[model samples]
Target: MALSVGDATLAALAGVAIRRKPARSGAVHRTGAPVLRDSVEAGTFEEAFFAVPAKGETDRLLHVARKTLDAARRLRRDARLGAKILTTSERVIARLTGSAVRVYEEILTLARLNRGRVFPSYDYLADATGLGRATIGRALAILEAIGFLVRQRRFNRVAGQGPGPRYEQTSNAYRPLLPERVLSYLPRWLRPAPLPEDEVQRYADREADTRYMLKSLSCRELAEATVSGSLGKILAKLGAAVDRREREAQIDPQPLTDSYNKAQTVLA
Candidate 1:
């Protein structure tokens, strides 16, 4: 018998089991059932589960789904484009100085976090990016010199007037540079073949559906449930859109032009 969506969802939530065939080759393989795949499938199925709701809830679900799908589609497009740019930048930096590529990524991560108002201390960044504190400090200095980061000093008059310095991006620094980087640096082998627009649209639709399922819950409840469940990653992805927009607004147009010019020179 075919299971209803609700039934399948509940069973998945309760933890379904699947049998795995043993591998052969004279290897001492441990015989045991794998549960990770079932768990993942269950999570995916749960995101699609929606119980019959009151009159207006169906329309609300559809609206949220549409918005989520739109955001997801744009995200996928941006990510693919961004990856291409970064790959190209990596190759250019690698050729210049083998170590520069990693430093460049560190700068990018810092810039991303800054957009989210998440300024990590030197120690925090050193631990997170696995770069030495001195290296991270040097990279931050370079980023500021290159117009990727701007240091602002604010005085806290209420608290004895001490000077506090914070880093900020010049303005759309990443977005334009990313597209240029993708077009210039992507080695032919590493470039993903162009995906059909229809396939991209399908992914967008699926993302939207998943988002609608989450949106059905109240915001506070959803936050609590997400922390306790497997939906944290999804929530994080959804939240990134806001940060991306803020970063785009602050990106400096001139550096992007310079980065594009530099990329063209490297490609040439």
Candidate 2:
């Protein structure tokens, strides 16, 4: 987390020269504008776009961070980066190994403070992540393949010619590509998040199980419940109506002999 000149390589430590003081953790005082969390009432979200009480500078900066984190979360979830890398998999593998992603984010954390630039050498990455040189190399490769990171080359300096170094090679430069910004390279239409065949079948099975659960739990009274509070009364009335309708039905095929004789005598 701190800078060590002797240990780092020129290519990877490009973003390390700058340092920012941590945000002071204390009670924030309210100032100019009210946040939306403070204003949400029953009526409408459109009218009252109030925000949470940002008491001080700390809270305000935190508010900004929360917004950024939320945006990053959305971009991460909806992105089909795994599928993009493994073309044969074609399905969105939302949950992949985080080793590479973690490294990518560590670079982003530095880049965010450094104004969208990160050039950590593999050594710095290894030191920060506690991973081996080869592992870090693989992680960086994966990140580049998935379009979450990019790099630039800086001209190596010759000691005699211009700068302090004796002989210089091109040092690596890096940029962390955010999810939302990735659309520039990987279009939305091209990045379709599909489910694998097995996953799709499992989801279908789950749906069927849920439907059965609902059917087993369902009742005629509940179905007949038209209003909210008076369900019992409604059910009682429905039961009575059903009984009466059954009594009114005349299903007999023939009249009794006594009734027939009475009818004949009355006609006579």
Best by TM-score: 2
Kindly list the per-residue Cα lDDT of model 1 for residues 1-268, writing each as its tens digit.
Answer: 6777887787798786332343233332233322222122222222223122344433332233233334334445655677533343343222222122344444344444443232345676677678888876675554444332333321111222335432221211121012222232334443346789999999999999989988875544465456534466566555566556656777844477888999999999
Candidate 2: tens digits of C-alpha lDDT, residues 70-107: 43444455554542233222212222235666676667
Off by over 4 Å in 1: 1-98, 102-133, 140-183, 225-268
RMSD of each: 29.7, 28.5
Candidate 2 lowest-lDDT run of ten: 32-41
Q: For candidate 1, which ten residues in a row score worst on lDDT?
A: 169-178
